[model samples]
Target: MGTRGQSSAMGREARDPRLDAVIQTLQEIGNLMGRQAQERAANIAQATEAATTAAVNGNQANQGQAQLKPPKFDGKGDPEAAPRWVEELEKAFEVLGCTEAEKVTLAVYLLQDNANDWWKATRGRVFPEGTAQTWAVFSENFYGKFFSESAKERKLAEFMRLHQGQMTVDQYEAEFARLSKFAPRMIDHPEDKA
Candidate 1:
Protein backbone atom coordinates (compact mmCIF):
# COMPACT_ATOMS: atom_id res chain seq x y z
CA MET A 1 0.00 0.00 0.00
CA GLY A 2 2.88 2.40 0.83
CA THR A 3 4.71 1.69 -2.46
CA ARG A 4 1.50 2.33 -4.47
CA GLY A 5 0.96 5.73 -2.77
CA GLN A 6 4.62 6.80 -3.41
CA SER A 7 4.38 5.84 -7.12
CA SER A 8 1.09 7.75 -7.48
CA ALA A 9 2.67 10.84 -5.89
CA MET A 10 5.68 10.59 -8.25
CA GLY A 11 3.37 10.25 -11.23
CA ARG A 12 1.44 13.42 -10.27
CA GLU A 13 4.71 15.34 -9.77
CA ALA A 14 5.95 14.29 -13.24
CA ARG A 15 2.66 15.52 -14.94
CA ASP A 16 2.59 18.91 -13.15
CA PRO A 17 5.12 20.67 -15.50
CA ARG A 18 3.26 19.40 -18.64
CA LEU A 19 -0.06 20.58 -17.20
CA ASP A 20 1.41 24.00 -16.41
CA ALA A 21 2.88 24.31 -19.99
CA VAL A 22 -0.53 23.38 -21.51
CA ILE A 23 -2.27 25.94 -19.29
CA GLN A 24 0.29 28.68 -20.29
CA THR A 25 -0.15 27.88 -24.00
CA LEU A 26 -3.94 28.03 -23.67
CA GLN A 27 -3.75 31.44 -21.91
CA GLU A 28 -1.39 32.81 -24.64
CA ILE A 29 -3.77 31.58 -27.39
CA GLY A 30 -6.76 33.14 -25.58
CA ASN A 31 -4.93 36.52 -25.30
CA LEU A 32 -3.98 36.51 -29.00
CA MET A 33 -7.60 35.67 -29.97
CA GLY A 34 -8.87 38.45 -27.72
CA ARG A 35 -6.49 40.97 -29.36
CA GLN A 36 -7.60 39.84 -32.82
CA ALA A 37 -11.24 40.23 -31.82
CA GLN A 38 -10.55 43.73 -30.48
CA GLU A 39 -8.82 44.75 -33.73
CA ARG A 40 -11.74 43.46 -35.82
CA ALA A 41 -14.22 45.33 -33.65
CA ALA A 42 -12.24 48.58 -34.01
CA ASN A 43 -12.09 48.18 -37.80
CA ILE A 44 -15.85 47.65 -37.91
CA ALA A 45 -16.40 50.77 -35.80
CA GLN A 46 -14.20 52.91 -38.04
CA ALA A 47 -15.94 51.65 -41.20
CA THR A 48 -19.34 52.39 -39.68
CA GLU A 49 -18.24 55.89 -38.71
CA ALA A 50 -16.96 56.55 -42.24
CA ALA A 51 -20.23 55.33 -43.76
CA THR A 52 -22.24 57.55 -41.40
CA THR A 53 -20.14 60.59 -42.28
CA ALA A 54 -20.57 60.00 -46.01
CA ALA A 55 -24.34 59.67 -45.61
CA VAL A 56 -24.49 62.90 -43.61
CA ASN A 57 -22.43 64.79 -46.17
CA GLY A 58 -24.63 63.49 -49.00
CA ASN A 59 -27.75 64.63 -47.15
CA GLN A 60 -26.29 68.08 -46.59
CA ALA A 61 -25.44 68.44 -50.26
CA ASN A 62 -28.94 67.35 -51.19
CA GLN A 63 -30.38 69.93 -48.82
CA GLY A 64 -28.28 72.68 -50.35
CA GLN A 65 -29.41 71.71 -53.85
CA ALA A 66 -33.02 71.58 -52.68
CA GLN A 67 -32.86 75.20 -51.49
CA LEU A 68 -31.92 76.37 -54.98
CA LYS A 69 -34.74 77.28 -57.41
CA PRO A 70 -33.26 77.79 -60.88
CA PRO A 71 -35.46 79.29 -63.61
CA LYS A 72 -36.85 77.07 -66.37
CA PHE A 73 -36.16 77.52 -70.10
CA ASP A 74 -38.67 76.51 -72.77
CA GLY A 75 -36.55 77.44 -75.84
CA LYS A 76 -39.05 80.13 -76.87
CA GLY A 77 -39.46 83.92 -76.54
CA ASP A 78 -36.67 86.44 -77.16
CA PRO A 79 -33.37 85.23 -78.63
CA GLU A 80 -31.60 87.08 -75.77
CA ALA A 81 -33.54 84.98 -73.28
CA ALA A 82 -31.06 82.08 -73.79
CA PRO A 83 -28.11 84.10 -72.51
CA ARG A 84 -30.16 85.51 -69.64
CA TRP A 85 -31.25 82.02 -68.53
CA VAL A 86 -27.64 80.82 -68.74
CA GLU A 87 -26.48 83.75 -66.65
CA GLU A 88 -29.10 83.12 -63.95
CA LEU A 89 -28.29 79.39 -63.87
CA GLU A 90 -24.58 80.14 -63.62
CA LYS A 91 -25.19 82.44 -60.67
CA ALA A 92 -27.24 79.78 -58.95
CA PHE A 93 -24.49 77.22 -59.56
CA GLU A 94 -21.89 79.56 -58.09
CA VAL A 95 -23.97 80.02 -54.94
CA LEU A 96 -24.55 76.28 -54.64
CA GLY A 97 -20.86 75.36 -55.10
CA CYS A 98 -21.86 72.95 -57.83
CA THR A 99 -19.38 70.74 -59.64
CA GLU A 100 -19.26 70.81 -63.46
CA ALA A 101 -21.29 67.61 -63.65
CA GLU A 102 -23.81 68.99 -61.21
CA LYS A 103 -24.07 72.21 -63.21
CA VAL A 104 -24.93 70.31 -66.42
CA THR A 105 -27.35 68.00 -64.61
CA LEU A 106 -29.18 70.83 -62.85
CA ALA A 107 -29.27 72.97 -65.98
CA VAL A 108 -30.77 70.09 -67.92
CA TYR A 109 -33.32 69.50 -65.17
CA LEU A 110 -34.44 73.13 -65.46
CA LEU A 111 -35.04 72.82 -69.19
CA GLN A 112 -38.75 72.54 -70.15
CA ASP A 113 -40.86 72.01 -73.28
CA ASN A 114 -38.88 72.87 -76.43
CA ALA A 115 -35.56 73.29 -74.55
CA ASN A 116 -35.92 69.84 -73.00
CA ASP A 117 -36.75 68.37 -76.40
CA TRP A 118 -33.68 70.04 -77.93
CA TRP A 119 -31.42 68.65 -75.20
CA LYS A 120 -32.83 65.16 -75.60
CA ALA A 121 -32.10 65.27 -79.34
CA THR A 122 -28.65 66.82 -78.92
CA ARG A 123 -27.46 64.83 -75.93
CA GLY A 124 -26.45 61.74 -77.87
CA ARG A 125 -24.48 63.79 -80.38
CA VAL A 126 -22.83 66.08 -77.83
CA PHE A 127 -21.99 63.48 -75.19
CA PRO A 128 -21.46 59.96 -76.46
CA GLU A 129 -21.32 56.97 -74.13
CA GLY A 130 -18.31 57.09 -71.75
CA THR A 131 -17.62 60.73 -72.68
CA ALA A 132 -17.30 63.36 -69.98
CA GLN A 133 -20.36 65.64 -69.69
CA THR A 134 -18.86 69.06 -69.00
CA TRP A 135 -20.33 72.55 -68.49
CA ALA A 136 -18.15 74.00 -71.26
CA VAL A 137 -19.43 71.40 -73.68
CA PHE A 138 -23.00 72.07 -72.71
CA SER A 139 -22.49 75.83 -73.05
CA GLU A 140 -21.04 75.46 -76.52
CA ASN A 141 -23.95 73.32 -77.65
CA PHE A 142 -26.51 75.65 -76.04
CA TYR A 143 -25.05 78.83 -77.55
CA GLY A 144 -24.67 77.21 -80.93
CA LYS A 145 -28.31 76.17 -80.88
CA PHE A 146 -29.77 79.42 -79.54
CA PHE A 147 -27.40 82.30 -80.33
CA SER A 148 -27.05 82.88 -84.08
CA GLU A 149 -23.89 84.25 -85.68
CA SER A 150 -25.91 86.95 -87.46
CA ALA A 151 -27.30 88.20 -84.14
CA LYS A 152 -23.82 88.22 -82.61
CA GLU A 153 -22.41 90.13 -85.59
CA ARG A 154 -25.28 92.63 -85.38
CA LYS A 155 -24.57 93.20 -81.68
CA LEU A 156 -20.88 93.68 -82.40
CA ALA A 157 -21.70 96.24 -85.09
CA GLU A 158 -24.01 98.08 -82.67
CA PHE A 159 -21.29 98.10 -79.98
CA MET A 160 -18.76 99.52 -82.47
CA ARG A 161 -21.20 102.25 -83.55
CA LEU A 162 -22.12 103.35 -80.00
CA HIS A 163 -21.37 106.98 -79.03
CA GLN A 164 -22.14 109.29 -76.03
CA GLY A 165 -23.13 112.19 -78.36
CA GLN A 166 -26.57 113.79 -77.58
CA MET A 167 -27.18 111.36 -74.68
CA THR A 168 -27.27 111.93 -70.91
CA VAL A 169 -24.21 110.73 -68.91
CA ASP A 170 -26.25 107.99 -67.13
CA GLN A 171 -27.91 106.94 -70.40
CA TYR A 172 -24.55 106.78 -72.20
CA GLU A 173 -23.01 104.76 -69.36
CA ALA A 174 -25.94 102.31 -69.35
CA GLU A 175 -25.83 101.93 -73.13
CA PHE A 176 -22.04 101.39 -73.05
CA ALA A 177 -22.42 98.74 -70.34
CA ARG A 178 -25.16 96.96 -72.28
CA LEU A 179 -23.32 96.93 -75.65
CA SER A 180 -19.83 96.30 -74.22
CA LYS A 181 -20.78 92.69 -73.53
CA PHE A 182 -20.78 92.11 -77.30
CA ALA A 183 -17.22 93.38 -77.76
CA PRO A 184 -15.24 92.50 -74.63
CA ARG A 185 -11.83 92.83 -76.38
CA MET A 186 -12.58 96.44 -77.44
CA ILE A 187 -12.80 97.45 -73.76
CA ASP A 188 -10.52 94.77 -72.30
CA HIS A 189 -8.36 97.40 -70.51
CA PRO A 190 -9.81 99.52 -67.68
CA GLU A 191 -8.50 102.74 -69.26
CA ASP A 192 -10.04 101.78 -72.62
CA LYS A 193 -13.36 100.96 -70.84
CA ALA A 194 -13.33 104.36 -69.09
Candidate 2:
Protein backbone atom coordinates (compact mmCIF):
# COMPACT_ATOMS: atom_id res chain seq x y z
CA MET A 1 0.00 0.00 0.00
CA GLY A 2 2.97 2.34 -0.18
CA THR A 3 2.59 5.22 -2.57
CA ARG A 4 5.16 7.89 -3.57
CA GLY A 5 8.08 6.52 -1.52
CA GLN A 6 7.72 2.85 -2.61
CA SER A 7 10.97 0.99 -3.33
CA SER A 8 11.33 -1.24 -6.43
CA ALA A 9 12.71 -4.83 -6.71
CA MET A 10 16.31 -3.38 -6.52
CA GLY A 11 15.49 -2.21 -2.91
CA ARG A 12 17.15 1.21 -3.32
CA GLU A 13 15.56 4.32 -1.69
CA ALA A 14 12.49 5.49 -3.61
CA ARG A 15 13.46 8.07 -6.27
CA ASP A 16 12.36 11.68 -5.64
CA PRO A 17 10.09 13.51 -8.13
CA ARG A 18 12.89 15.53 -9.77
CA LEU A 19 14.94 12.40 -10.12
CA ASP A 20 11.81 10.36 -11.06
CA ALA A 21 11.77 12.07 -14.44
CA VAL A 22 15.26 10.72 -15.24
CA ILE A 23 14.28 7.31 -13.75
CA GLN A 24 11.19 7.21 -15.96
CA THR A 25 13.33 7.84 -19.10
CA LEU A 26 15.79 5.18 -18.04
CA GLN A 27 12.90 2.76 -17.40
CA GLU A 28 11.54 3.43 -20.88
CA ILE A 29 14.97 2.69 -22.45
CA GLY A 30 15.23 -0.57 -20.47
CA ASN A 31 11.69 -1.68 -21.66
CA LEU A 32 12.67 -0.88 -25.25
CA MET A 33 15.88 -2.90 -24.96
CA GLY A 34 13.97 -5.85 -23.39
CA ARG A 35 11.39 -5.83 -26.24
CA GLN A 36 14.23 -5.70 -28.79
CA ALA A 37 15.91 -8.67 -27.14
CA GLN A 38 12.61 -10.69 -27.18
CA GLU A 39 12.10 -9.86 -30.88
CA ARG A 40 15.66 -10.89 -31.77
CA ALA A 41 15.30 -14.17 -29.76
CA ALA A 42 12.06 -15.01 -31.61
CA ASN A 43 13.68 -14.31 -35.01
CA ILE A 44 16.66 -16.51 -34.22
CA ALA A 45 14.42 -19.38 -33.10
CA GLN A 46 12.33 -19.15 -36.30
CA ALA A 47 15.41 -19.02 -38.55
CA THR A 48 17.02 -22.05 -36.82
CA GLU A 49 13.76 -24.03 -37.06
CA ALA A 50 13.44 -23.16 -40.77
CA ALA A 51 17.08 -24.20 -41.43
CA THR A 52 16.56 -27.56 -39.63
CA THR A 53 13.32 -28.24 -41.58
CA ALA A 54 15.01 -27.37 -44.89
CA ALA A 55 17.96 -29.65 -44.15
CA VAL A 56 15.65 -32.55 -43.21
CA ASN A 57 13.57 -32.02 -46.36
CA GLY A 58 16.70 -31.89 -48.51
CA ASN A 59 18.01 -35.13 -46.98
CA GLN A 60 14.68 -36.90 -47.52
CA ALA A 61 14.49 -35.77 -51.13
CA ASN A 62 18.04 -36.95 -51.83
CA GLN A 63 17.32 -40.35 -50.28
CA GLY A 64 14.17 -40.75 -52.41
CA GLN A 65 16.01 -39.84 -55.62
CA ALA A 66 18.82 -42.20 -54.82
CA GLN A 67 16.38 -45.10 -54.30
CA LEU A 68 14.47 -44.39 -57.58
CA LYS A 69 17.51 -43.89 -59.83
CA PRO A 70 19.13 -46.93 -61.49
CA PRO A 71 22.87 -47.46 -61.12
CA LYS A 72 25.05 -45.92 -63.81
CA PHE A 73 26.23 -48.70 -66.10
CA ASP A 74 28.81 -48.59 -68.87
CA GLY A 75 26.94 -51.27 -70.91
CA LYS A 76 29.73 -50.52 -73.37
CA GLY A 77 29.22 -53.85 -75.14
CA ASP A 78 28.41 -57.47 -74.48
CA PRO A 79 30.93 -59.08 -72.11
CA GLU A 80 33.83 -60.98 -73.65
CA ALA A 81 33.20 -64.66 -74.52
CA ALA A 82 34.66 -65.75 -71.17
CA PRO A 83 35.18 -63.94 -67.89
CA ARG A 84 38.53 -62.07 -67.46
CA TRP A 85 39.71 -64.65 -64.87
CA VAL A 86 39.98 -67.23 -67.65
CA GLU A 87 42.61 -65.08 -69.39
CA GLU A 88 44.62 -64.81 -66.18
CA LEU A 89 44.40 -68.59 -65.74
CA GLU A 90 45.62 -69.02 -69.33
CA LYS A 91 48.59 -66.73 -68.70
CA ALA A 92 49.47 -68.71 -65.54
CA PHE A 93 49.14 -71.90 -67.58
CA GLU A 94 51.83 -70.72 -70.02
CA VAL A 95 54.37 -70.39 -67.23
CA LEU A 96 53.56 -73.87 -65.90
CA GLY A 97 55.55 -76.54 -67.78
CA CYS A 98 54.18 -79.67 -66.11
CA THR A 99 51.38 -82.13 -67.03
CA GLU A 100 48.90 -80.44 -64.67
CA ALA A 101 49.10 -77.18 -66.62
CA GLU A 102 48.74 -79.03 -69.92
CA LYS A 103 45.83 -81.03 -68.58
CA VAL A 104 44.17 -77.94 -67.12
CA THR A 105 44.55 -76.05 -70.41
CA LEU A 106 42.95 -78.99 -72.25
CA ALA A 107 40.12 -79.13 -69.70
CA VAL A 108 39.38 -75.40 -70.01
CA TYR A 109 39.11 -75.45 -73.82
CA LEU A 110 37.28 -78.78 -73.84
CA LEU A 111 34.33 -76.98 -72.20
CA GLN A 112 34.70 -78.35 -68.66
CA ASP A 113 36.14 -81.67 -69.77
CA ASN A 114 38.41 -83.81 -67.58
CA ALA A 115 41.87 -85.14 -68.46
CA ASN A 116 41.21 -88.67 -67.17
CA ASP A 117 42.35 -90.19 -70.45
CA TRP A 118 45.40 -87.94 -70.73
CA TRP A 119 46.42 -89.11 -67.26
CA LYS A 120 45.74 -92.72 -68.18
CA ALA A 121 47.67 -92.48 -71.46
CA THR A 122 50.80 -91.17 -69.72
CA ARG A 123 50.22 -93.26 -66.56
CA GLY A 124 52.81 -96.07 -66.63
CA ARG A 125 56.25 -96.21 -68.22
CA VAL A 126 56.81 -98.86 -70.88
CA PHE A 127 60.27 -100.47 -70.51
CA PRO A 128 61.49 -100.86 -74.14
CA GLU A 129 62.66 -104.30 -75.37
CA GLY A 130 66.37 -103.42 -75.96
CA THR A 131 67.15 -101.60 -72.64
CA ALA A 132 67.36 -103.32 -69.21
CA GLN A 133 67.25 -99.81 -67.71
CA THR A 134 63.61 -98.70 -67.16
CA TRP A 135 64.64 -94.96 -67.04
CA ALA A 136 64.72 -94.63 -70.85
CA VAL A 137 61.14 -95.83 -70.98
CA PHE A 138 60.24 -93.35 -68.22
CA SER A 139 61.77 -90.46 -70.21
CA GLU A 140 60.18 -91.27 -73.61
CA ASN A 141 56.65 -91.64 -72.22
CA PHE A 142 56.66 -88.76 -69.73
CA TYR A 143 59.10 -85.96 -70.62
CA GLY A 144 59.74 -84.33 -74.03
CA LYS A 145 60.13 -87.21 -76.51
CA PHE A 146 63.88 -87.10 -77.19
CA PHE A 147 66.57 -86.19 -74.59
CA SER A 148 70.29 -85.71 -75.39
CA GLU A 149 72.32 -88.89 -74.64
CA SER A 150 74.36 -87.29 -71.80
CA ALA A 151 71.21 -85.59 -70.42
CA LYS A 152 69.43 -88.92 -70.60
CA GLU A 153 72.28 -90.69 -68.71
CA ARG A 154 72.45 -87.94 -66.05
CA LYS A 155 68.69 -88.05 -65.53
CA LEU A 156 68.63 -91.86 -65.47
CA ALA A 157 71.42 -91.90 -62.87
CA GLU A 158 69.58 -89.35 -60.67
CA PHE A 159 66.34 -91.27 -61.04
CA MET A 160 68.00 -94.60 -60.10
CA ARG A 161 69.63 -93.03 -57.02
CA LEU A 162 66.36 -91.34 -55.87
CA HIS A 163 63.93 -94.16 -56.66
CA GLN A 164 66.46 -96.94 -55.94
CA GLY A 165 65.69 -98.68 -59.31
CA GLN A 166 61.91 -98.40 -58.64
CA MET A 167 59.84 -95.46 -60.00
CA THR A 168 56.22 -94.54 -59.49
CA VAL A 169 53.87 -93.70 -62.37
CA ASP A 170 53.46 -89.97 -61.87
CA GLN A 171 56.54 -89.15 -59.75
CA TYR A 172 59.22 -88.34 -62.37
CA GLU A 173 56.64 -86.74 -64.70
CA ALA A 174 56.22 -83.96 -62.15
CA GLU A 175 59.90 -83.24 -61.36
CA PHE A 176 61.42 -83.89 -64.83
CA ALA A 177 60.20 -80.65 -66.41
CA ARG A 178 61.58 -78.54 -63.50
CA LEU A 179 64.85 -80.52 -63.29
CA SER A 180 65.47 -80.79 -67.02
CA LYS A 181 66.32 -77.12 -67.61
CA PHE A 182 69.94 -78.28 -67.73
CA ALA A 183 68.86 -81.30 -69.70
CA PRO A 184 68.96 -80.41 -73.39
CA ARG A 185 65.81 -80.64 -75.47
CA MET A 186 65.51 -84.13 -76.90
CA ILE A 187 63.05 -82.98 -79.57
CA ASP A 188 61.99 -79.64 -80.97
CA HIS A 189 58.24 -79.10 -80.84
CA PRO A 190 56.34 -76.08 -82.17
CA GLU A 191 54.82 -73.67 -79.62
CA ASP A 192 51.48 -74.39 -81.23
CA LYS A 193 50.05 -77.29 -79.22
CA ALA A 194 46.72 -76.77 -80.91
Candidate 3:
Protein backbone atom coordinates (compact mmCIF):
# COMPACT_ATOMS: atom_id res chain seq x y z
CA MET A 1 0.00 0.00 0.00
CA GLY A 2 2.83 2.52 0.73
CA THR A 3 4.58 1.63 -2.55
CA ARG A 4 1.33 2.15 -4.50
CA GLY A 5 0.73 5.58 -2.81
CA GLN A 6 4.31 6.71 -3.50
CA SER A 7 4.06 5.83 -7.20
CA SER A 8 0.74 7.75 -7.55
CA ALA A 9 2.29 10.79 -5.76
CA MET A 10 5.36 10.70 -7.98
CA GLY A 11 3.19 10.55 -11.11
CA ARG A 12 1.15 13.58 -9.95
CA GLU A 13 4.37 15.59 -9.21
CA ALA A 14 5.81 14.81 -12.64
CA ARG A 15 2.63 16.00 -14.45
CA ASP A 16 2.43 19.22 -12.37
CA PRO A 17 6.07 20.16 -13.16
CA ARG A 18 5.57 19.56 -16.88
CA LEU A 19 2.31 21.59 -16.92
CA ASP A 20 3.97 24.52 -15.09
CA ALA A 21 6.91 24.54 -17.52
CA VAL A 22 4.52 24.56 -20.54
CA ILE A 23 2.51 27.51 -19.04
CA GLN A 24 5.71 29.51 -18.38
CA THR A 25 6.95 28.93 -21.95
CA LEU A 26 3.61 30.07 -23.37
CA GLN A 27 3.61 33.24 -21.20
CA GLU A 28 7.12 34.14 -22.37
CA ILE A 29 6.12 33.73 -26.04
CA GLY A 30 3.02 35.93 -25.49
CA ASN A 31 5.11 38.67 -23.93
CA LEU A 32 7.58 38.62 -26.78
CA MET A 33 4.74 38.76 -29.34
CA GLY A 34 3.17 41.76 -27.53
CA ARG A 35 6.46 43.65 -27.63
CA GLN A 36 6.97 42.90 -31.34
CA ALA A 37 3.39 44.09 -32.12
CA GLN A 38 4.00 47.31 -30.18
CA GLU A 39 7.21 47.94 -32.08
CA ARG A 40 5.46 47.33 -35.42
CA ALA A 41 2.65 49.74 -34.50
CA ALA A 42 5.15 52.42 -33.53
CA ASN A 43 7.07 51.98 -36.76
CA ILE A 44 3.85 52.21 -38.83
CA ALA A 45 2.78 55.40 -37.02
CA GLN A 46 6.17 56.97 -37.60
CA ALA A 47 6.05 56.15 -41.32
CA THR A 48 2.56 57.64 -41.70
CA GLU A 49 3.64 60.85 -39.98
CA ALA A 50 6.71 61.16 -42.16
CA ALA A 51 4.69 60.64 -45.35
CA THR A 52 2.18 63.33 -44.33
CA THR A 53 4.96 65.80 -43.56
CA ALA A 54 6.67 65.10 -46.87
CA ALA A 55 3.42 65.75 -48.80
CA VAL A 56 2.90 69.08 -47.08
CA ASN A 57 6.50 70.11 -47.74
CA GLY A 58 6.18 69.15 -51.39
CA ASN A 59 3.03 71.32 -51.72
CA GLN A 60 4.83 74.28 -50.19
CA ALA A 61 7.76 73.87 -52.55
CA ASN A 62 5.42 73.75 -55.54
CA GLN A 63 3.69 76.93 -54.39
CA GLY A 64 7.07 78.67 -54.03
CA GLN A 65 8.04 77.61 -57.53
CA ALA A 66 4.75 78.90 -58.96
CA GLN A 67 5.28 82.30 -57.33
CA LEU A 68 8.80 82.52 -58.75
CA LYS A 69 7.46 82.03 -62.30
CA PRO A 70 4.37 84.18 -62.78
CA PRO A 71 1.60 83.09 -65.17
CA LYS A 72 1.27 84.47 -68.69
CA PHE A 73 -1.55 86.84 -69.69
CA ASP A 74 -3.60 86.54 -72.90
CA GLY A 75 -4.16 90.39 -73.00
CA LYS A 76 -7.94 90.30 -72.99
CA GLY A 77 -9.74 93.34 -71.54
CA ASP A 78 -12.88 95.45 -71.95
CA PRO A 79 -13.23 98.86 -70.29
CA GLU A 80 -17.03 98.79 -70.03
CA ALA A 81 -17.37 95.07 -69.28
CA ALA A 82 -14.29 94.68 -67.05
CA PRO A 83 -13.90 97.99 -65.24
CA ARG A 84 -10.74 96.86 -63.42
CA TRP A 85 -8.74 96.73 -66.68
CA VAL A 86 -5.88 98.84 -65.32
CA GLU A 87 -5.34 96.54 -62.35
CA GLU A 88 -5.39 93.44 -64.54
CA LEU A 89 -3.00 95.08 -67.01
CA GLU A 90 -0.54 95.97 -64.27
CA LYS A 91 -0.57 92.42 -62.95
CA ALA A 92 0.03 91.09 -66.45
CA PHE A 93 2.92 93.52 -66.99
CA GLU A 94 4.62 92.35 -63.83
CA VAL A 95 4.11 88.72 -64.89
CA LEU A 96 5.42 89.38 -68.40
CA GLY A 97 8.65 90.95 -67.07
CA CYS A 98 7.91 94.26 -68.81
CA THR A 99 10.30 97.11 -68.01
CA GLU A 100 9.18 100.68 -67.24
CA ALA A 101 10.22 101.82 -70.74
CA GLU A 102 8.37 98.96 -72.45
CA LYS A 103 5.17 99.41 -70.40
CA VAL A 104 3.70 102.19 -72.56
CA THR A 105 4.22 100.29 -75.82
CA LEU A 106 2.99 97.06 -74.22
CA ALA A 107 -0.04 98.91 -72.91
CA VAL A 108 -0.69 100.18 -76.42
CA TYR A 109 -0.38 96.62 -77.79
CA LEU A 110 -2.70 95.08 -75.21
CA LEU A 111 -5.40 97.77 -75.49
CA GLN A 112 -8.76 96.64 -76.88
CA ASP A 113 -9.99 98.53 -79.99
CA ASN A 114 -12.34 100.82 -78.05
CA ALA A 115 -9.80 101.30 -75.22
CA ASN A 116 -7.21 102.24 -77.85
CA ASP A 117 -9.62 104.86 -79.16
CA TRP A 118 -9.96 106.35 -75.69
CA TRP A 119 -6.20 106.14 -75.18
CA LYS A 120 -5.58 108.05 -78.43
CA ALA A 121 -8.23 110.67 -77.60
CA THR A 122 -6.97 111.28 -74.05
CA ARG A 123 -3.22 110.60 -74.34
CA GLY A 124 -2.06 114.22 -74.84
CA ARG A 125 -5.07 115.70 -73.02
CA VAL A 126 -4.40 113.71 -69.81
CA PHE A 127 -0.64 113.09 -70.15
CA PRO A 128 2.04 114.56 -72.43
CA GLU A 129 2.83 112.75 -75.71
CA GLY A 130 6.04 110.62 -75.96
CA THR A 131 6.74 110.64 -72.23
CA ALA A 132 9.21 108.00 -70.93
CA GLN A 133 6.96 107.13 -68.02
CA THR A 134 6.26 104.27 -65.66
CA TRP A 135 3.20 102.00 -65.66
CA ALA A 136 1.70 104.36 -63.06
CA VAL A 137 1.57 107.19 -65.63
CA PHE A 138 -0.07 104.97 -68.22
CA SER A 139 -2.56 103.67 -65.67
CA GLU A 140 -3.49 107.19 -64.58
CA ASN A 141 -3.93 108.31 -68.16
CA PHE A 142 -6.15 105.34 -69.10
CA TYR A 143 -8.21 105.35 -65.93
CA GLY A 144 -8.56 109.15 -65.94
CA LYS A 145 -10.15 109.07 -69.39
CA PHE A 146 -12.73 106.46 -68.33
CA PHE A 147 -13.09 107.14 -64.57
CA SER A 148 -14.13 110.78 -64.30
CA GLU A 149 -13.69 112.98 -61.23
CA SER A 150 -17.44 112.87 -60.72
CA ALA A 151 -17.37 109.07 -60.48
CA LYS A 152 -14.53 109.15 -57.93
CA GLU A 153 -16.44 111.71 -55.90
CA ARG A 154 -19.55 109.54 -56.01
CA LYS A 155 -17.56 106.47 -54.90
CA LEU A 156 -15.97 108.48 -52.08
CA ALA A 157 -19.37 109.71 -50.96
CA GLU A 158 -20.75 106.17 -50.95
CA PHE A 159 -17.73 104.97 -48.96
CA MET A 160 -18.29 107.76 -46.40
CA ARG A 161 -21.99 106.92 -46.11
CA LEU A 162 -21.36 103.21 -45.48
CA HIS A 163 -23.33 101.58 -42.66
CA GLN A 164 -22.88 98.24 -40.89
CA GLY A 165 -26.24 96.94 -42.11
CA GLN A 166 -26.92 93.22 -41.66
CA MET A 167 -23.22 92.55 -41.13
CA THR A 168 -21.19 91.35 -38.16
CA VAL A 169 -18.79 93.76 -36.45
CA ASP A 170 -15.81 92.07 -38.09
CA GLN A 171 -17.45 92.23 -41.52
CA TYR A 172 -18.35 95.87 -41.02
CA GLU A 173 -14.79 96.65 -39.99
CA ALA A 174 -13.36 94.88 -43.07
CA GLU A 175 -15.79 96.69 -45.38
CA PHE A 176 -14.96 100.01 -43.78
CA ALA A 177 -11.23 99.34 -44.23
CA ARG A 178 -11.72 98.42 -47.88
CA LEU A 179 -13.82 101.53 -48.64
CA SER A 180 -11.42 103.79 -46.73
CA LYS A 181 -8.82 103.33 -49.48
CA PHE A 182 -11.17 105.03 -51.95
CA ALA A 183 -11.40 108.16 -49.80
CA PRO A 184 -8.10 108.66 -47.97
CA ARG A 185 -8.79 112.35 -47.34
CA MET A 186 -12.29 111.82 -45.92
CA ILE A 187 -11.29 110.07 -42.67
CA ASP A 188 -8.44 112.13 -41.19
CA HIS A 189 -9.04 111.26 -37.52
CA PRO A 190 -8.50 107.70 -36.22
CA GLU A 191 -11.59 108.05 -33.98
CA ASP A 192 -13.78 108.75 -37.04
CA LYS A 193 -12.12 105.80 -38.81
CA ALA A 194 -13.14 103.40 -36.07
Q: Tell me the spans in candidate 2 whose CA falls farther than 4 Å from its real position.
A: 1-16, 59-194
Tens digits of per-residue lDDT for model 1 on 1-194? 99999999999878878889999999999999899777755764554455456556777645544434557999887777887788888877776556678789989999999989999998999999999889999998998887777767788788888989999999999998977886787778656544
Candidate 1 lands at a TM-score of 0.59
Error of 2 at 53 (Å): 0.7
lDDT of 3 by residue, 96-165 (tens): 4556765676667766666667666777765576766677777676656666676677667779789999
Assess every candidate by TM-score.
0.59, 0.23, 0.46
**Count of residue pairs whose backbone atoms collide, per candidate:** 0, 1, 0
Error of 1 at 89 (Å): 1.3
| Candidate achieving higher lDDT, 1 or 2 | 1
Which pairs clash inside model 1?
none
Ranking by lDDT: 1, 3, 2
Query: What are the per-residue Cα lDDT tens digits for candidate 2 across 55-89?
Result: 56777645533232112212122222122223433
Error of 1 at 23 (Å): 38
Between prediction 2 and prediction 3, which has the larger lDDT?
A: 3
